[model samples]
Each structure stands twice: as C-alpha cells, then as structure tokens.
Target: MIPPSSCGVLVVGSGNAGFSAAISAAQSGAGSVLLIDKCPESWTGGNSYFTAGAYRIAHDGLASILPLVSNVSSEQAERIDLEPYTEADFARDMRTVCGGRSDPELSRVLVEDSGDAVRWLARNGVRFWLSFNRQAYEVDGRTKFWGGLCLRTPDGGKSLIADLQASAAQHGVTTSFSTALVDLRYQGSDGVVATVRCDDGRRHEITARAVILAAGGFEASPSLRSQYLGPGWDMAYVRGTPYNTGDVLELAVRSLGAQTFGNWSSCHSVAWDASASTDPNAGDREASNEYTKSGYPLGLMLNAEGQRFVDEGVDLRNYTYAKFGRAILSQPGHLAFQVWDSQTSGMLRAEEYRPERAEHITGRTIEELAKACADKGLLDAEAFVRTVHEYNEAVYAHRRENPSARFDPSMKDGLSTQSSGKRLSLAKSNWALPLDQGPFLAVKVTCGVTFTFGGLRVDPQTAQLLSPGGGKIPRVYCCGEMLGGLFYGNYPGGSGLTSGTVFGRRAGRAAAAAAAAVEEEGDLVRS
Candidate 1:
C-alpha cells in the first residue's frame, strides 16, 4: 500500500468534535485537512451517533430561540411557551451537577459561548428543532417546554452524524475510515507524528503541522475501565462505540507528559436495559441507548435487596441520570428496578415500552408486583412489599397535608412524601407518589456507561493540550470527551454535545493558524 505523507491538520476520530475541527480548520485557511477513524465507514461517527442529538444552549426565551430553531412557523413560535435559560442558569447547572468540581474558566466559556457554538453548527448546515419528543410534553391545550433543554438535532444522533459528515465533505475535508492510530511521537519544536494502521494491515507514519486529538475516552476498553474506574466497571455495558480505548489519552499522558484532570472513577452513565447487547458492532443491537430508562425520576428505584438506593426524585432526569448509574452498579447483583404505576406510565419515553427490547414486568397490585419480581428472581417478595407499604404511607401522609395539590410531571413540582413515622435513610426530594394504583410497571436495568470523564487537561482558550509542567504541547490540541476539567462526579444532559462544538471549533482555528505559521516560517510544505 502506498502511504500518504502529511496534511496541514490531522483530526483523529470523525465524530461531531472531529468533523467540527476538520471543517473549521479547512474554512479557516488550512489547505489540507484529514480526519481518520478506527471504525469502518458503516460505524464511523463514534459515540455521537448514539447520542440523543440534544444541545443545551443558553437562551432568553422563545423570541431569542427563533433565530436558532429551524422551520419554526411564526404561529407555532407564538403558541409555545419556553422559559428562559440564561447564562447564570447554565453555569449553575454545570457547577451543581459536577459537585463544584468543574473548572471555573471552562464552565464560563461553555456557558457564555454555547449559543454561538450552536448557531455556528446551524450555519454549517446542521439542522435543529425544538426537542419535542425527549424534552417537552403537552399540557392542557398548549405545548410547554421545561428543563432548559430546548434544542435538538432533528432525527436524533444518526441524523446529526450524517449532516455533520455531509458538511465536512462539502467543505473539502478528507475522511479516511478504518485507519487506527497506534502511536504518537512528538518532536521537540518540529511537530507530531502519528503512526496509523490502515485496513490492509499496512502501518504508516503520518506527520502533520498540528494535531487535534478528539478520539474520545476510555469507556469502551474493559481493561482501562477496570484500571481507572475501579473493580466492577468492566462488567458494565457501554452505551457507545467500543473503539474509544484510551489510545490518545495514553499517548498524550504517558508518552508526552500531559496532565490529566477530572474524577477518574466518575463518568456519564445511565440505567440501561440489562438485556442489551455488550457487542458494539452487533447489527441487531438490542440496547443501543434506546434502552436508557430515564423515567426513574418519575418513579421508584429498588435494588435487588428490595431497598431504595437513591433518591429518584432528587432532581430532573437530565441532572441526576448520569450519576445514578454508579448507584445502580453499587447495588447487589449490579441491578436496579424502576417501578411505576399506570398514572405515570404513559409519560415514559417510547423507548421504555418497546416490547421486544425492554425487560418489563407488569402486575395488577403491589403484592402481585412483588410476586412477579420474585418469580423473575430479581428481588425479595416480602422485602419488596414492606418497602412499598412504607413508601406508600409516606405518600398518603404527604397528600393528606395538601389535599388540593396535584402532581405535575413537567418540572420539580414539589410533589413529595413525608416519612409518616416510617423513617428511611433516603428521601424522595420531589415527585413522590403512591404505588396504590393498580397495574404497576417495572423495568430492570444495569449500569451503562456513556463516556469517561478523566482526560488530558487543556487550555480551554485554545484547546491546546497542557503538559505536566503547565505549558502547551507545541502544536497539539484536544477536544470532545478527551478534554478534561469541564466535568466531574456528574454531568448535566446535553452539555457533552455543546462542549464538543465549542472546543472543537476553537481547536480547529488554533490548529489552522499553527499549520499556516509552519508553512510561512519554513517556506516548505511537507506533503
């Protein structure tokens, strides 16, 4: 096989972040840009293809959202009521969800520039729509959107990947799939050399004036998951591509002395169907994130011991879903069951109701539910009944105190239960309801990881990877899940995609500038 020598800018991993970097580099005057991915052409978008395509942007109201939303008729815009999600709210959400571990500078940049980053994607041909299916619900006669999550890439992650790749192609960005990076060698003031293996089993060295590593985190590799995330993480199902084996992270940190940040044990995980496929490349994939049971916030989560492990109503699903996976993993048998009644069952996302896809159990009464759970060998029947009885007493007491109060699923509507003398270790913060309603529903789930948080620390300003000595690594930059210090402990939903665009754009511009400088100073282009 003939080996191509070099390019102006090389982007590793052709997902949202990689494509964003390549397109921006090409548009910013870089003559040649190439993006390579380990996956073949069919599975090339990385984890972004599995995402919900949601983007968290800081906007003032429906009026300000009009410019960003696509195909919104004036009549529909006037009819919908969208609460303002300001910059302050964005920063507060990041800090709160990460347990105040997020870097202040990175948080500020993400919150302040999120709107512009989203608009930039829209300008680059990625389409957008109000997240009607996943985010909002209809109330009375009108549509009311809540949770500060309004924008989404239409048709979900698959469509987002298609459009971004199309934009990359339109702007003359070259893509090489099935090319895996094996090693990276940095030359002191010269540049970085990437050793890659192509589909033909041929190895080649590709040198570039600047490198933007957006390959992703270590969630897919079982060994890395066990090494960084601790003991039982290797058993958890991955919600994304298996190709993110921490190659770039290892090369940058161990080989180039890059500093790493964020909580290594923490990652963005969720309660996924225990029946889901562990194979990322499986064509008949049973649980490819369509199995995410996010409706636990509207119900109760009981572990195998027939005990509640987490306050399911502590916050919106967007704010708490990422961290609850740890709770599920810590449970006995590494499983949890989300129990809901007919009252809120209809409110669940359509994904939860797929007959062939979910591990669902239904019963007409609480006792029957316990029997069904016991029949499945998932929980103790007596212990489950006792737990339900105690919880229902609390709900009844709370309702008796406020007879006129009604349950609202749109937001944290202060629907909570009182202990009523049966004190439990964990308390439901809000949306607490009784299981007295018949025909109860329960879905079994285990922890499913999305992406690891701990990664190479970088300067958020230029997206340049920083060294252990607190200096830039010459011409190397990083983006996406590989850029650390922005999230820890937990992650607010939709921030991942938004941060990818923000840092990806910045890294691309910086990389293009660096490549141009090299050409000017040496008066020679290494092709």
Candidate 2:
C-alpha cells in the first residue's frame, strides 16, 4: 500500500528506535505519525529482532526492578543477589569501554535516562524479565547477577519488537514496510520533504512537519565496511538484518549536510559461529542470536597457530565480547577455537552453546582436542598442546601461591594466570582454571559485525540532527545507530538497545512539539 503524502511526524526505520519514535509522537499528540522501513514485513524489527534483548540500566538493586519484571518469583528473588548499578557506575563503564572517546553529553544523557527509559518501555506494553540465562551465575547456591545487566524482554528481541509494535498501533501510528528513504531535505520553517521508494518500485514524496531518522548504520554494506572500518571487515558475518545498508545515512550526509561523529573504524562485533552464513541476506532469522559464541569468557581462545592471543577473562563477557571479534578477525584465517573443560562446560549459556545449536568438537584429553582442532584447521597441533600445557602450569602455580583465591564467575575474582612464581605472556585475569578436566570441548568462531559506530551527530537533549555548520537542523532528528558518539572502540553489552530507546523517545517528543508549533503557525496565518 502507498503511504500518505504528508504526516505530522515521519519516521524512517521500523526497528525499536523507529517504533519508539512513532509511538511517542502519537502519544505526544502528533496528529498523524507514519513509520516506514526498507525491509519487508517479515523483517519487521530490523537488527533489534536478532538481539538478546538485554538492557543495562542504573537502579537501586534487585528490589528496584522487581516490580517491572515477571520472570522472578518471591522465592527466586530471595536467592538472587543484585547490587545497585549507580549512574556513576554506568558512566565509568561508558568511559572505560569507549576509551574516553564517547561524546560526553551523549553518554551522560544515556546514563541518566537509562532506568526511566526501561521503565517507560515496560509501561508501553513491553514485558520485562530478569536475564537469568545470560547475566547470572549460581554461586554458593545463590543466583548472582553480574556485569550490571539484569533486565530483558521475554523471548529477547522478538517479544520486544512485538510489544512495541503493538503499542505503536494502539496509539494510531501507521506503518509501511518495504519502503526505502531515498533522500531527505530540511526546509526550515516550511518543514521537510522526503523522497521514498515503495515496494512496487515507485517513488513518492512525503512532506512532514518533522522527520526522525532511525534507519540504522552501515554494517551490512561491504564497500562501506571496507572503506570506513578498514580492510577485512567486509568478510565479517552480518549478524542482523541485511537491509541496514546505510542508504539513509549516506543520503542525510550528502543531501542534508548532517555532520558525522564517533569512531568510524570500530563497530559492535562479536565472535560468531564459523559455520554461520556469510551472505548478508542469509542470516538465520529463526536461530537469531544463538549464532553467537560468547563462551570464551569461561574458557580460552586459540588461533590456528595454537597460541593464546588474548586474555579471555580480562573482564565480564559483556565488556569484552564486542571487541574480541576484531581480535579473532586478526588471527590466522580469521578463525579461532574456544576451548573449555568439563569444569566450566555447564556454565556456558545453553542457548548459544547447546550441542544442537553449536557444533562442538570434543575429546577425552587436551592432546586429543588439539588433534581434533588440527583436523578442523589448526596449523600447529603440537603448538596447541604445548600452549595448553604451559597455561595449565601457570594456573597451577598461581593457585598454589594464592590457595584462598577461589574461582568465581559472578565477580572479578582475581584467579589469574599470574603470580610471583609463574606468569603467561598473556594472562587470564579472572576465572582462570587448568584445562585438565576432560572431555574438553572446542568451537570454531569468526567475526560477526552487529552494527557500525559511525553516524550523524545529534543533539543530546532533543535528538535533533546537528548541522556541519554548528546548529541543530530545524525539524530533523535521528536515533538508534544513526545517532553516533555513544560508542567507540568497544561497547558494553545491552547498552545499544537502551540508548536507542532513550534517544528515540526524545526525538519523538521533540518532533511532535515541532509539528504542533508548525500547525499553530499555519492556523494564525489562515486567521
């Protein structure tokens, strides 16, 4: 169906950010809100449909969020240990992970508004749940939630999009699928004119008092990846919707002179299943986020050269997973193996590492595991065996030096492979254990790019697009991955979704107010 030629607010993209903007615009009294997406109806939520749905927010404690989630019972809540995540904690994480390059104002807004944004999501029909499967570990018979992430939507991103879409519809927002934004031109007080291509291969012009661009980044574009993120990025697997080809971003920059910001050479990449398809459009929507291979934090990773290249336990998986994909891509053949012993095999998230979901190579001993890896593509089986032996010795020496330092996955329990007596060239900083327990398991992984970090700069308060010349564009806004400067070299897991909602809501309300002002001016002119 062809969309109407005009609207109070026109939102491009049908993902979480777009839905948030459309819903908020209608709820904020925008007379007519329209949302459009380049993807078909089946790809309704875009990249958000493939997320684990984790949302990082600052809160008082478990009790603070208990009222919003449905997954925990009174009995379960008693056994759960959750510490308060303060605004300072969130800010520190952003600063640390982004290497102090994240935009100050953007990071501050995201940190301060995170909790309220999550609560707003719950109030708008999105069901919440404690992320026990991904964020918690059993310690001393108690469930300890770690990594400062505790909440998610049930069924992950699938339910998140469903609920948000329902809310948008309930608010009388109209949606058009298979509609691509071709160009956008801001007209100051006259409003904005957008050219869009519909599914029938027809082009139409849409005039709106305000426009919100949430059309995602350029991760799926091979040429853009190679150009912006440097070489070898084009080979990385596309983890989400292939439709985010950066068309809207490019148009905004070319036609509207939107200023781009943040780290263009970095992205939210992760260790993905090596067997996953490389074709941009061939993502297994049914399998969704299960293609992730994030169990490295519980084990160790070895490249084909059979060497431990990175500290797997440098921090919680949330902090390291996003950047490890780059490390893996730099390894030989862009491939690596994650090996775990029986001691920590059960701790792996079943959704990602279950035998049926992941192809695991197992052997009764470390040497046998190395041989199995050799068959898969390990260039040096002997080096693989020697590396394990050396790591085991270091772990043993450290254990002897500090016998009281117990292994704890719930916190940064410094059971590292470093001591006065022995130290590996690269140390596992936490949860280090000897790979002596058999049968050992290994899974091959390659880099998977989730989204790019480079995008248009927008005002932190209003989410309005900022001009290259230094002022906000009159009636234009941006949200989601399209609004850059929040992330840099790496990302803290679950923060992307939260940032999207925070900025999306802001852009929506601001656009609605702008539309109202335009309508008021027209009324006065007519009178």
Candidate 3:
C-alpha cells in the first residue's frame, strides 16, 4: 500500500527475482523500496511459484555443498556419492545444450556467480535440500546424485517464495499487488517515472531513482506465442502464471528502446499432462510443476501415430527435457504417450506420477496398453504394440552382445540400442532396458511452456538494460526471464532459478547504488 509518489527504488514483479532485487536493494540502504505486480497477492510469486526451485551450482563435491543444505543427515551424507560440478562442467552443458550459441559473457557470469548467489540466498532466508528424489538413484543401498543438480528448496517453489517474501518484508521492502506497470520513461535528473494501473482501474505515475524490471517473459500470451514462437504454439498449455503477459517487457522495448536478444522461437517447455487445463490462466496452483511428466528418460514416448518420435535416452533428463517439448509439439497431434514397464515404473518421481496428481493408464500386456492408448486418442493401436516389440528386441540384442552393460540411471551407462547389430530408425542412447516386464503404465502428455528464451538484453555485470545503441539505459536494470541471451534452444535443469538469483542480486545492488548516487547529487544541490 504505497502512495503513487516517489521511492528510492522501484521493482516490477513479485516473483523470486523481483523479491531478490527488492531485498537486495533495501539491504544496500536504498530507502523506500517498492515492489509491484500485476496480479493479486494470491498470484504473488508469478512463474517461480510453479517451479521445482532447483539451483545448479559449481561446487567441490558433497563437502562443498553440505554446509548449504538442511536435508542430509550425517549417515545419509556418508552413503551419498555426490560428484563435484565445476564451472567448466556447467559451461560445457550450456554450450552443448544451446548448440554453442549461448552468450559467453552472460554464461560466464551465471556460472561463476552461481555459488555465491546460492550462498547469499541461504544467508537470507531461503532453505535448500538435496534433490534426492529428482537427481539421485539408489544403487546397492547407496544414493548416487546425478546431473549436476543437487539442491532444491524444500517443497519446491512454494517454499522458495515464502522465504523470499519473508526476507523482503524484514528488510523494509513494501509490496503492492494488482499494480500493473503500463509505461516506463527516464526523466533524466528527475529519475525514472513509471505509469501504473491499479486493480480499481486507477492510473498513476510513480517516480523512482532507479527501476528494476523482473516481470518475466511472454509465454502466457497466445498472440505473442503464435507470433514469435511460430504456429501451433498458441495451443501450448502454460505451466506457470498467466499474468506474465510481457506487459513490462513490451513496455521496456517500446518506450525505452531496449534491445531484444536470444532465440524468440524457442522456450523452456516440457512434457505436461494432456488432461491438464488448457486455459492459460487456469493452471492448477496446487499441482504446479507436478503436471510435468519427465519420466520419459526412463522409458519411451510414442506419438498418436504410434511411432517413437524422439530418442528418449539421448541424454540425462536435465539436458533433454526442455527441447523435447518442441519435439512433442511437432508430432502428429501435438501429443505423446510415455510408457514404462514394471521394471522402471517405481523409478518415476512420486510427486509427478502419483495417481492422485496425474492420470495413469495401465495394462497387463503391450497389446492391452496399445488398445488403452488408442481409446485415449492414439491413432494406430497395432503400430503402438509393434513399436514396443521392436524396442524390446533391440534392447535384448544389445544386451546379448554386451552382457556387462547394465542400466544405471545415475550415470550415462553405455547400455544403448545402438550397440546391437540391428537398429531402429531411432535409437535409445542410454538406459535401454527391454520393456518386457509384466504390467505396463502409460501417461498422455502435451507441451507445457514454462518461459520464453528471448528477452531484453542487459549488461552481464550490472544487469542494466542495454540500449539498442549499445549502452546501458539510465538507472534501469533487468533480471530473471526478462533478461535474455543466456539460454537459446535448451537449458540445463535448475539453471533458470540460479541465473535469476545471480542477476537479481546484481540488478538489486546496481539499482541501489544508482539510487544512492541520485540522492547524493540532490543533497549537493541543496547544500
């Protein structure tokens, strides 16, 4: 409930990045910081509230990260086989996933500052735990954490928002919900003036010495999706907040001449429940990220035509899941079915695959499963069964040649269909175990867009929005999904939240310093 008058720093959006900037600004002695969001207080955290809150950081194995988490017991720690994730490893993933097009400067900052940013978040109020359920596998009574992702907020993004909000309030930052930023302009010596519309339809202008925009991308806007992300994207279900319609981002570019960067045609999408609500505004708040069916890496995905459209085991789930949504969308009906035998059904994450959270179809045999999938809109029942049989045959042939090869999800075991003399048009690169075990489970999925990869370009060091002319915009900073060029085609799991924290902290500090400098200049004039 702040008056539409003046403040030292103004922040748009109330998600993790916004709160990170607000709290950082307040802590840095920026007086009268105000945070505003277009949605009501119920929709406070924006898309961040729907995330797994995973943070990927470079560390020295279990010993380096053990101090930052609260979930690992002394006995549990001893049995954990955690490997160190260095900056080089992180950078290599960024390059490989993005096809070597990720901005080197932004990637460097995100990787180098990730550890310190995570530690800073811990120093504030955010709590982290080992991502045991999502990133580890138990082999021989020992937990082996795979994929460089190890830490996540307990209970996922909900707890992340709660902790960040608490920290912001403690730091004297005020929040105003249902306050949408309509326009932004720099007034030179008078600072940045933002025109905002309140829920009551009242419009007013607020002046701030420095302004930070962290309002997220335009993934929720169907028009923008169809326009930028290409055809059929308008039908993609949104996995996060519908309120992030790119209002502030558009405002920045239109009014401030902010430079746009990165791949507008790609986004952080995933395999989502086909039964989930299609209405962008109607995302199940309780279900949140649980709608994601990421168990494909452990099994196979067939399109409506009953053909394998992707190499499900091409890489770890962290590396492949983001781009697979586009693959799923390109299929016949923009839908696919993930099938797993009894052998790997238990490996699926309970939070995502529990019957209460997701719809599951089971059958006693491959033929029965195919029939059931046909009932659920599969185009060809016979092809579905044939595909399964062919996959099983390939797996068996590979195993016969290389009996030493074993299916281990903890690492990229060389157990692949390609190892066999016979080959299918598409091959499972890893975790290729014959799916001949008893009853099988299948889940229907479609594309659920998480966020856009394209956004305003910002300086990697200060997070200040880069003007089209190749300079920083005066006193304006940007972070989170609104600042682009770090991710292009795909991103490693858990890097989004870490990148947000890194640049959010940078933008906050830079905005606060700008505000202080403005105040000092005014003080000198008065003196």
lDDT of 2 by residue, 321-359 (tens): 999999999898999999999999988998999877788
Q: Cα deviation in Å at residue 472, candidate 3?
A: 1.3
| Clashing residue pairs for model 3 | none
lDDT of 3 by residue, 10-119 (tens): 99988888999999899888898999999999998989999999999999899999999999899999999999999999999989998998999999999999999999
The total number of steric clashes, by the backbone 3 Å criterion, in model 3 comes to 0
lDDT of 3 at 495: 93
Q: What total of clashing residue pairs does each candidate reach? A: 0, 0, 0
Off by over 4 Å in 3: 278-281
Q: What is the lDDT for 435 in model 1?
A: 80
Residue 471 deviation, candidate 2, in Å? 1.0
Residue pairs in collision within model 2: none
- Estimated TM-score per prediction? 0.95, 0.98, 0.99
Q: Per-residue lDDT for 146 in model 3?
A: 91
